[model samples]
Target: MHLNYLANIGRYIPEVILVLLMVGLIILEATYKEDEKNRKYIFIATLVGLVATLGALIANMSGKAEAIFSNSIIIDQFSTLIKMVMVLGTLAAIYLSRFSKDIYESLKTEFAIMAVGILIGGFLLASANNMLTFYLGIETLSILSYVMAALKKNDQRSSEAGLKYALYGGISAGLMLFGMSHIFGVLGTIQFAGVAKMIPTLTSAQLAILMPSFVLLFAGIGYKIASVPFHMWSPDVYEGSPTPVTTFFAIVPKLAGIAALIRITAVFFVVDSPMKIGWIGLLIVISALTMTVGNVTAIGQKSVKRMLAYSSISHAGIMLAGIVVINDVGIRSVVFYGITYLFMTLVAFYITSIVQDKYGNDHFDRFSGLIYRYPFMAVMMAVVMFSLTGLPPLAGFVAKYNIISSLINSKNYALAIVLGLNSVVSAYYYLKIVRLMTLKPQESNEEIEGFGFLNQMVIVSMTVPVFVLGIFWETIMNLAAGAKLFIQ
Candidate 1:
């Protein structure tokens, strides 16, 4: 028994490493003087630690799936892949925070610390095998996020964002707990596998009870993914938070929530039941509404950051579309979409953050005549925008294509059509930046300090993946094909 637990630790190394890293950063941070501006050592340590965590996840990928720590968590390719995506997103955010003026210099180290802590929560959520671990993961991710959102000490918007996030989060958590308790009371177990076992055997009366309980349960996950109705806070929070924190919020929590949602859908809905039917119906409505609401809302946004926030809500809707199909193909498509999304989102935010840092806001006009001063960056942003619009021969196209194809294969034609229409609607705002960058006259000839040669190279490096993944996506699709949920 002892040896088995020790062996499970091997599968858990990545998370352990991150916890240690967070603690080490805290200690290292204290050693520095309060007024120290250049915390190069902290930056170096953070990068090194994140890289090591990525390495650990890569190593875990090769191992067979297992229910570790007495099945409280399941380490599988699906969860591990999502963890890798989250880690990469974190890496990019940390690097961005290093130079971003949006966050206070003193709080930068704190950002790294909290990011790792949230990442740990994401890891737990991704692999969670039971209700206890699942709720714990959500709370852990939420608590840290509230602080990160308000990192700008003097900014009232930041404070408001944090407060709003906390209030909404508290409500969601409470509702989710209420749902979980009802589930536990009715089913007599908090273990997901046990719940699955009881689901198909549910009486009609029990089904009626569980249905609403599950909807309440979805409130928590849906809030995390920023899906509709529960997505009210996303834009305000995104606009109010530091850009780097917004970037992190876009990638990590959203992906983590999607991963958890996928697992719950796949595990609990496998056996046909009235509950499955109800759940699928609910997802279909939410998916369509989320996509429609997000795209329509994004069309009028002037702030590039807030626009991207609505856009992310729409993207979450697309990912939810993948889950609607409820098969290996759907899961594979979602995973592939997630991988491509990381690169596209990172590049877009990096450019936006850099531009915002220079101009004090991420208004659409800030990008006007960008090609005149910084052609490379303007082109990179254009590429990201095109990809985001689901234009051909780019990663976003392939990602969208995969999901549509999966939906078609499943005869889920209605949602697929909705996804298609949303992409078209998205083009207006996404291409708005492109038009501004190319067609408008230059805002200024002054060079953006954020677009230094090294930073441009980094942006280019990230953009290359967008192109490569579009044309050469088969390799990744194959990898995603292997990322199946391991249900016990």
Candidate 2:
């Protein structure tokens, strides 16, 4: 438990502040009428949330990896960096959620508590070194996500999204649990680093069992990250849930899941023998298929929300390209691309959230003539879309360049070419959004107000990270190339 205290007050600094602030707001509201007096509380909570998270991240950078709670949990640079991203993304989601008044007032306490609970899970995932710890983290995030998706009790779509996510998520968890049992049987240990050390000695028969277990484990991770074959849930969930919650799904959950995957696969996956050949080949095939299918199908989507959903899947494939290399560059590229992916996607979703909130529709055609309706939003949306397309001068392309260049250097140019061509294919649909907004005229001819100040808050805050990170990516690339949580 002392390990928890090293960052101690610093460890959950964000969670503690958010929870306490949320409690204060609820208690104050108990004594007051239904006035809009508590708006200040939410804004202050947002500020504290961001500050505490950033502070903890900075603090963690100076510390060594330590296992708290009798070695069940571990903290280091990798966990710290991933946690920083999750906290920042969650804060952005909270910021974009400023307009959700009724949901905010009615469920203020629950929302805050659940959000902190989810953060705890995300933190646990980052630091998780053992099977029990990983399971605990994944369950915590999943349960809270279900509740969040269902927060709109009056909306049937929200309820349906919750039901489907819970059902699919539960099955994935079960599969993972089954795989853990096999892993334990083969190695007599569930601690990942321990398993990695022991895995090198296992017999061919043991490797046979391990391979399927790997797939089952990958299924659970893929569902969480919305990777292909397990991505059936994303579009429905994204399109059905309220925009704010959907935005949350887009940002933090995806990052946490992917980061966890990188950590586990990089360390614990034992590729020791010829029998283990199957898993690597399987991953390579999945990596190719995920990129090709996600990009190809996304082109036909009419809803911008669903398009982004599929776009995320395609990007996941690109991230997996880094996974294929399995070296310093692969690891760093995952982190680097993960960084770029979060800001680009979150800002794009933020723009869509604001537009949908203002217009009461999210259809692709509705985006037509948006440049005429609100020029600022149109420009911001275009930046986000361009970034997502992996275009030059944006962080997305830089992310792709690093990953593909690394893969090619690793003598995997076939996969690199696939990734490159997919990027080109993806550009068509992403720019299609821009063309619609700029070229087509508004269908109704009735005017919509320029985004109000509150909405602009969401747009401007998300937009800065998307563009600035693209220009100054070198420092991050350097950091990522050298990042190793277990070492200095």
Candidate 3:
């Protein structure tokens, strides 16, 4: 029995490494004076630790799938792939925090600490096989996020953002728990497998009770992904938080939520029943609304961060569209979309962060005539924008294409059409930056010091994948195809 537990621990090394890394950072942070601006060792240590965690996840990818820790968690390629994406997102955000001027120098270390802690939660949530572990994961991710959002203690907007996040999170958590309790009461077990076993056999009375319970349960996951209705806080929080934090939010928690949602849809709805019909109907409505609402609202946003915030919400809707198909192809498409999204989002935010640091704001005008000053960055931004709009021969196009194809294969024509229309609507805002960068005059002749050679190289390198993945996506699609959920 003890040997079995020890083996489970072996499979869980990535999260363990992160926990140890967080503690080490705390101790290292204390050794420095409070006012010290540069903490190079802390940065170095964080990078090394994250790299190690990524390596562990890569190693885990080839292993067999199994439920561990008393079957509360499952280790599988799907969860492992999502974890890798989250780790990569964290790594980028940490690097960005190292130089971003928005965050207080003293608070930078705290950001790294909180980020890793949230990542641990994300890992748990991605693989959670039961309601108990699922709720624990959501709370862990939420509490740290509240602190990270309000990271700029002196900034009133940041404080408001944090408070709003906390209040909403508390309500969402409570409702999710309430729903979970009813589920337990009806099914007599918190285990997801047990719930699945009971779902197909449910009587009409039980189905009535379970349907609403499932909707309530979705509230928690939906909030995390920033889907429509539950997405009220996303733009405000994204705008109010530091750019690095915003970047992290766009990638990690959102993908983690999608991963969990995919698992639930695949597991609970695998067997055909009336409950499956209700769930799919709910996803279809939410997916269309989320996509339309996000795109329509983004058209008027002036702040680049806020625009991206809505953009992310819309992107989440697209990912949800992938889940609506409820098949291996849908799952693979969502995974591929996530991989491409991580790169595009990171590059966009990295450039935006650097530009904001230079200009003291992320307004659209800040990018005016960027091509004249930094043509390479201007082109990179243009490419990402085009890709974001689902243009041809770019990663975003392929990602969107995969999802639409999957939907079409499944005859989900309406949602696919909604996704297509949303992409057109998105072009207005995404291309707005492109037009400003190329058509407008330079804001100033002064060079943005943030675009130093090394930083420029890093941005360019990140953008490389945006192009490569678009053309050579088959390799990645195969990898994504292998990320199957372990259903027991």
- Across residues 194-251, which tens digit of lDDT does each residue of candidate 3 receive? 9988988999999888889999999999999999989999999999999999999999
Model 2, TM vs. native: 0.91
How well is each residue in 1-488 modelled by candidate 2, as lDDT tens digits? 24545444554454455556556645654654565545555556555756776786777677767665666767778778888888777777776665543244555445554565677677777677788988888888898998987777887888898889899899999999898888888888888778878766777788888878878878877888888888888888888877767877876777778777777766764465453355556667878898999999999998888888889888888887787776667778788888888788777877777667666778898788988867888898898888888887888878888898998898887898999899889999999999999999887666554367776776677778766778888886676556564331
RMSD of each: 1.2, 2.9, 1.2
| Model 3 lDDT on a 0 to 1 scale | 0.93
Q: For residues 15-83, what per-residue lDDT tens digits would candidate 1 score against the true structure?
A: 999999999999999999998999999999999999999999999998888887767899988899899
Stretches of model 2 off by over 4 angstroms after superposition: 1-39, 100-105, 269-277, 444-450, 479-488
Candidate 1 matches the true fold with a TM-score of 0.98
Clashing pairs in 2: 5-8
**Ranking according to lDDT, highest score first:** 1, 3, 2
Say what the RMSD of model 3 is: 1.2
